[model samples]
Target chain A: MRLGPALGWFSRNYNYEVETQAPLQKHSVGSQQRTPIMYASLFEQKVVPVKHSTKFRDESVMKSKRISKFLWVGALGSVVVVSGLAEKVYPGKVAPSSPAQTTNSASTTGTSGYNVTSSTLAPPPASATAPSGLSATSGSSSSGSAAAAAPTAGS
Target chain B: MRQVLFRQDTLGTSCFLTSRVEGVDFERRFIAACETFSERLFELDQVASRFRQDSEVMRLSAENTGEPVSVSELLFDLVEAAMRAATITGGYLDPTVGNSMVGLGYSKDFELVRRDSADGMHFRVVLPSGYRTLVLDRVTRSISVPPGTILDLGATAKAFVADRICAELEHLYSLTCLVNLGGDISCSYVGQEVPWMVNLTSDGSLDPTSDGMLFGIAGGGLATSSVRSRNWLAGGTPHHHIIDPTSGESAVVDFESITVLAGSALDANIASCGAMAMGHRGIIWLRGTGLPAVVKRTNRTQMDGIARPWNGSELEFIGDWPEELVQLSGGVAC
Candidate 1:
């Protein structure tokens, strides 16, 4: 097929027409480049500029090969992208929000140098300091504004 | 429950971590954990602190050529945590405030900084809300920042340090523990009848703000953020450390102080910082997290974000804290 500036689109679209085909080359059908409409009726090309030799469909085969290769590379690239995201170090999950937090019990086996507690507790006394950092304390005041207008907590 | 208190100074403020136990070995192990905690804080400080020119944070800042720079694992994780806070706060609590701090004469330590008042002073803070510009590669443990942006991991990193210390205690000794970096506090307890008592003054000034009245906590963390502490004079006007990224100015009007209890020191501090910066409307922000909190405003109004028993007369509590009372920072403790 004769090619020119108009053929630039052909290169990008993986549509290559076998420009030089020896006469009676005996080319196999598999050697042709494939277009999306390769199976169209031969009569459809009668109005086109180029001659359509039944044996010179090598361009159509070439296009199919190129298209498949592009797809494989894209699949490989997508896998790499996903793997990268999976390995991201974001600690995204249920943030220790609820009153009960265990830091994923399975992940925390107390296998590290820390010792695990085995003791049970009795409910805290009214005057005792609770672990939640709440309590009725006996301390003098320094910040009047904060204390004077301070609101009591009740639940 | 039995209680033990440990205090030290590191990371630009006082460090407090609590442990509960009875036996003799408990003190020994608790002290050991404290030592490890102090070491970790120093290690992180050496890596993530912007005030120290020799810190990795400064090195990264100096070397930011719009290219990714390999950093210590600590710094890498620190930046990630700060980014998380920036995300949670909708950019109100930014870690990239180094340039903004410097713009306000906070280039040096707080004590070393000169307070000439902020009146009549014209200044521009680059990327006051630019924490999003930080590029972090967790796989490579590398980070990059936009040109002219400052990466300051003050609260996010500081709060995490507290959480990590408590986690470390839980990991090795499994000892009931609380790690407090300045006013940020974290605790871990497997099972106990009596909760840890953390006292707060009625004025909201001396709760974990100090070590006074008892607030009951079984686990998790607590923190207080206030602008009353880090005040400075900028051009004849008092300036503070907390800046509203949107305005590039101190967030003085938003709150006088805020105290929060959450699952970890990281959550507590990040939420409080964000709430403090949001001003009083931050109450809605804190309430959204469902964490228990108290906000003290400049007008001396107290608001509750969640439920807690305000039984003692000495420790006052306002009934049904309003969401729109112009809540401000109770105390700015990062």
Candidate 2:
């Protein structure tokens, strides 16, 4: 198998060679309902039916187009994974922009993991909510007899 | 079977009876019976007692200073019964010995009299009676008596209660029932499929080993009176509560115990108490009653006979016997 790979005429592409000549992977309303997330790639495939005969022929065509469409999507995902690795080696030049950039940026900003550093917060109010039963006449240590009198009423 | 036993230590007597087939609300009936009887018989107490206010004997005692007092129907009935007992026993048992009882120190309630003094260390107190000094008017229900007369009915009240309870239970529950007022037992059998079983022993204080008991399968009341139960010493003399009206003293009977089987346990109880009060001649007097009787003499001798349908032989065992005392062919007499 190694020698076969070395010869140019006998070489086969290691990357996926998708069959684009097959019918456009047109999705039925039932298939779209099954997995709504995967249907976006199916809409991009644009598959068409081979014949308008019985349901058997139409189903085979639909099945064949759906399988190829899935293979194409998997191949595209592999490319994205390889590109991510390449970006890690080459920095910002290999990175995908916009939608992927927003997701990556949002995740990194979430895990700051430090309570000391305030990203964004409001300042404390000038005065706190009033104590219902009594008013502190002075500081926490009680500056005068008025503070004692004000709290003594509660006791 | 349901039973409610009432024990008043003040009276020194036990009132116990068995009830069957009473409906859900039988407590009211039972308590009513107790209250009615207590009202009639509680006079012997020195404390403010119902008997002092209700008894004709007490009324007679009260009027001893001034004019003689006439008796009420309730008091008359009790006194007449006492008189009859005295007459039948030939003064062996007498209710008229009130002064003698009081002199012996039984004047107050038996429970209330304190025995702290050394002089009365061995003697128990009974009320004294002024028996001989009484003028009677039978038609007017009045009696005049001397002062210091204290009447005690510890003997007859139990038997009367047994009879009264039987009558009450018969009317309340249409079933065979028995009331044992301190072992003077009275029973009434409503139906006749089988005879009721009663244990007849020389004394109810039984020992498991000895054949000192008999089973009576009669359908009436039975009572046993014995000096073996209530005995005390007074003035260095061994005296019992069973008094002889003739002598105005405690009875001196030879028998350890005497049981009479009659048509009613009331009859048996009265006869037995009277006989015990009769001293030595109690057996002979009981024999004249024409009822079945068994007497266990103080000398360990015993006599048994079935003089009536309700009477039977003295028991020889403490166990149950299925056989009833059937009357023999030639009609038996006392």
Candidate 3:
């Protein structure tokens, strides 16, 4: 096989390509011999530190689990605290008129700074105390004679 | 079902009427009618009444000379009625006479006399600037008249209200209704009594002696206009507000009061007022309206004219009214 084609095939098969190659050096002796550095000190330095780092990573993992548990407990505690306060604020009816009413009551109770007055147009209820400044109630007794004999003639 | 009673002071009289209808709220309906009447009266009051500050008569009295302003819908109706009456009576029932009456010393309404003083009395033969110059445009509701046309719809306003109220009640309530505005009566009810019982007046009081003599009026309205009830002496001369448009003086008519029954109270009132104005022609003009009428004080004898409905022979003359039931305002004869 040709050297170029075989090298290309080998490079293609292995997915490797060389950008540049170093030039071969001629030695004064019969041949120049190359030796690789053993690097045992670098290996010792990297390996020991990696084992200590793994132990530290295990401690960080334990800390993350504790933090997640704390967050979950805090969320549940907030729900219980709000519901307890709401019971005192809003004494809601068990059987409400509609879903809209339920939503309104819930919203009204939770809102801390909002209050609304009811309608003023209606005649105050019989049992309820009349509002201030309104004329005192005169019952039907006052209108007996005039009401009975009125509208007698047309002109 | 609720019943509504409406009461108001208007058209020179107090009006009281009741309405009971199913599925209707009383106050709303009653108030609506009353408000409409008030609004219409307010508009007419400006152009028709001698009273009220904004009345056309008052306005003219203030300015003395100004072009007759554009008339409103209410004013137009009143002016048209008055003009027609003036024409019918040949100018006996003149509308332009606030100055004449005031000069005659009867400046205020009869109801407003609080111990009448002679200080305001000024008797001068001040003539009313005749109704001929007062031009009306029905489409625009505008009136152009000569300066100082003191228009007063004393009789006509009552008649107009009677007609208007009857028509309005029939439309809104879907029931037979009647409106009697100070004896200018109109009705919508049709029943066994085809001709309604209408009383004739002698000097603004019920003609007790001629009550039975007067004919019955069915379905239509009856109105009687008279100078007998409201006459007083001004500056040592007898003066009445019903001024004759021709001489610009009070009419010296043969009849004390003329009562006419017509299809509407407005027609009756106008005809009666016209009769008072026309002197002799009033009777003939009233006959033209094809309604029954009764005229008292013609040669000191009550001459009653019943329309085709009532037989003249059958209507017997009744004697003086019972003492207990003598009405202060003459109209009903016993």
Candidate 4:
């Protein structure tokens, strides 16, 4: 295929072009004739700008690959940090201690033992009392009249 | 000091809000307090009512895929309260009795259930799925239940709301308030000289002239759970609302009603329901807990050797239940 016109679109869009250098020639000096030392031939050059379309496509592929690599690394790092924090904070899989074990442990430590452990997420009752916050009506009042009264019924 | 009263129908029962306020503008403060209480009750019904199709609980039940569904803060707290009640009551007052309740022909409102005839209705004994099977994630504020496992919070939700309303009233208005939802009552106040008078009745009748016990409470919660008032017939057999999770049947106790006092209305309700479910052992259990309670046994005499030897109706008071004030023909005096 005739590549130049076929890849004309790439050149127009990317402004990429291949340039060829003239071959090295021998030059005469005052004492001796010296040949210009060629470090690398045009073909042997690392970045040989051959075809505009091919170079542009290769560069685009390389750029995408770099971005994808960074993305994968970033995603893996996020997973690691999240999982570590979750393990430390929640520990959802940790089995609760049995009542007997808790009591025995407390007894061994010379602490007051209870049937149920105090380490729970349940909020305490609204009253100041521990288990049952119920108390009797305080003081005897013969003068205080009933402000409002309601009947007790099961519903 | 001026006293104000507010009444509304809620949760298939009557809710009464009584407030004692000092200073001027008593009417405005009472109205504001009532509005707050009403709003909270409405929110709770939207979140916790099992009969309502649009409620959060019914929605959760519809999603029976055995997956955790995120719930609102109100519902999360309510369900958490139910779980706490179950834990404290040792599974006697279990929320997992929803299936049992429906199986016993109480699928609708109590009034509707009463209107329907139970001639040909077949009552099945549906055992509870157990509260342990329930999975609640506090961090995510989500709940998960096994497929076909329904949760009914009737045993504790009303009392929980009463406590919530009393607390909200005290915090918002700083007024001495008494919140009574059905028979679940909660009183909130700082320093008050007079205690709120309560007439204890088992037959759902609120009459000062009737021969009933009148007591006083300054703080905490007071709740009454009666098997007598909410009873209905199912296929020639009678059943009540309180279901024993062990048998998945109506709790048949010797007691006609049990009234309890606790630090919070939720606790009082739990204890009362638990005591009713425990049957004859309820008195012993209440004594162990050291909560003031009054248990009234059924008036009917049972057959010999069938159950506890019933010697007619008896009123048994436990702990430091206050002295009952005599109700005279004209008025009630201490």
* Winner by lDDT: 4
Please provide, for model 2 over B191-288, each residue's C-alpha lDDT reduced to its tens digit, 9 standing for 90 to 100.
Answer: 21222324443334321112233232223556777766455555667665677655566767766666665544545666777777766666666666
DockQ of each: 0.01, 0.00, 0.00, 0.05
1 or 4, greater by lDDT: 4
Q: Is candidate 2 or candidate 3 better by lDDT?
A: 3
Rank ordering of all candidates by lDDT, starting from the highest: 4, 1, 3, 2
Error of 3 at B89 (Å): 2.5
Query: In candidate 3, which residue ranges exceed 4 Å CA deviation?
Result: A1-155, B1-7, B18-35, B60-68, B117-120, B189-217, B298-334
RMSD of each: 32.2, 50.3, 44.6, 34.0
Q: What is the lDDT of residue B26 in candidate 1?
A: 60
Q: lDDT by residue for model 1 over A1-102, one digit each (tens)?
A: 222222243234433232211111121121112111111000000011121122223343345446656875896698667656655744354333224353
Q: Please tell me which model should have the higher TM-score, number 1 or number 4.
A: 4
For candidate 3, what is the TM-score?
0.54
Q: Put down candidate 3 lDDT per residue, B1-334, tens digits, no spaces.
A: 1223233344344443333333344334544554454455445444566655666646644664455455445556666666766665556666676667666665555544312534334477888887777776655656676665566677567676566666666567554444555556665534221122333432254222332322222245557677755677656677675777677778777666666655556666766777777776666665665545555554443345432222232221112111111122222211
lDDT of 2 at A31: 17
Model 4 spans with C-alpha error above 4 angstroms: A1-155, B190-192, B206-210, B300-312, B327-334
Ten consecutive residues with minimal summed lDDT in candidate 1 chain A?
A: A39-48
Point out where model 1 deviates above 4 Å: A1-155, B114-124, B202-213, B300-334
Chain A alone, TM-score for each of the models?
0.19, 0.23, 0.20, 0.22
- For A36-138, candidate 2 gives per-residue lDDT tens digits of 1111100011111112223453444356556656875896799888888988889877743311111111111122111212221111111111111111222
Predicted candidate 4 versus true structure: per-residue lDDT over B204-307, tens digit per residue? 44332344566656567778888755778888888888999999999878677788877667667878888888877776776677777877767662322223
